[model samples]
Target: LVRTGFEHLYEVYEKIDPKGARLLEESEPYVLTYLDFPKEHAHWIRTNNLCERLNKEIKKRTRVVGVFPLKQAMLRLVGAVCINQNEEWFVATHFMDKRSLLFEELPQREACTQETIDHLLQVIDSDFKVCREVA
Candidate 1:
């Protein structure tokens, strides 16, 4: 059986299918990029079900009308459905709770200045160089 995690599983696949394994290794950065997101947001980020469900709702509503006399009428119905869907789950209990999502405001910072911009660029350049060396 494949062992329980990414590295172990990758090692096994690498032995069995070197070409496929190389592709995965190349994609490893993107495949695992979700890990860089806040854990709480991972579920929503990793799946398109929410969007699919929203589209399904829109289609269901539009299908009922069969046809609209004006494009605006259809748009209005879709807009309302979007608003309702947004409100239905955009709640503290369901999700979209800023605190739970780690959306707290940052501590106030000094006003931006040209000097700070240059310093930030230098830090970024140095970090990028370090990463290039490691790679």
Candidate 2:
């Protein structure tokens, strides 16, 4: 049904405005990504409402704070907001029917290189030690 509607729109655009149709054709691959996901999940995947809402909330909170004393303080404030939002979502109405989710496992991430692992370990080890001598 969605694909049929998309095709009809393309046909109309091609007839009325060939340039507009060409632009749409260039974006066809990206626009059709929603169809690749489960129908139940398509609406959320196709929209930016969730991210826009979260960004608005963050901006409102930060506006009240004006300026943070440290980078860590800013991070803590945003992290707290995210935690609250996460808790709210658990109790809120379903975004999509829970039963419709496929619950498929995601592909495993690539392993970190030895150099990256060693650098991370160094940082972790340094964090446990004092930055300056006590005198």
Candidate 3:
């Protein structure tokens, strides 16, 4: 399934952005996995936060000067940020740590509760409507 998704993305990326497709091809497989992640799971790893954090780091480094003497300075700053984020994530504790607490503390709910399900469905429907309107 994952391989098929990557194949699909490789095809789409080649069509829409040949340069990006080439870059993707040159990247490690793990680095390119986000592009092929399922749409439902995409929201979990929203790229906006990643972009914003990178931009923040770049802006911080660039604020010392109005402009860089050459593009190398900017590239070096952003490259350092990418490397730092990669290392930081490797050392970070993740969701599994909270699993025991969640399993023990979660409120028990009846599976046959139609009212709860209907209310949740209504909430989702309203959110969809609002999203469509905003879009």
List the candidate 2 regions with Cα displacement exceeding 4 Å: 1-33, 103-135
Pitting candidate 1 against candidate 3, the one with the higher TM-score is: 1
Candidate 1: residue 120 lDDT (0-100): 59
Candidate 2 residues 1-135, lDDT tens each? 444445656665576579998998788888887656565576777888887888888999999999899999999999998888878876778676676556584333356676776565555345434432332
The estimated TM-scores of all candidates read 0.47, 0.49, 0.38
User: What CA root-mean-square deviation does each model show from the true structure?
Assistant: 15.7, 23.6, 11.0
Q: Candidate 1, clashing residue pairs?
A: none
The C-alpha stretches of model 3 lying farther than 4 A from their native spots are 1-54, 92-113, 131-135
Alpha carbon deviation, residue 67, candidate 1 (Å): 1.1
lDDT of each: 0.70, 0.70, 0.62
Candidate 3: Cα lDDT at 39: 39
Tell me the deviation in Å of residue 45 in model 3: 7.0
Clash count list over all predictions? 0, 0, 0
* Residue pairs in candidate 2 whose N, alpha carbon or C atoms collide under 3 angstroms: none
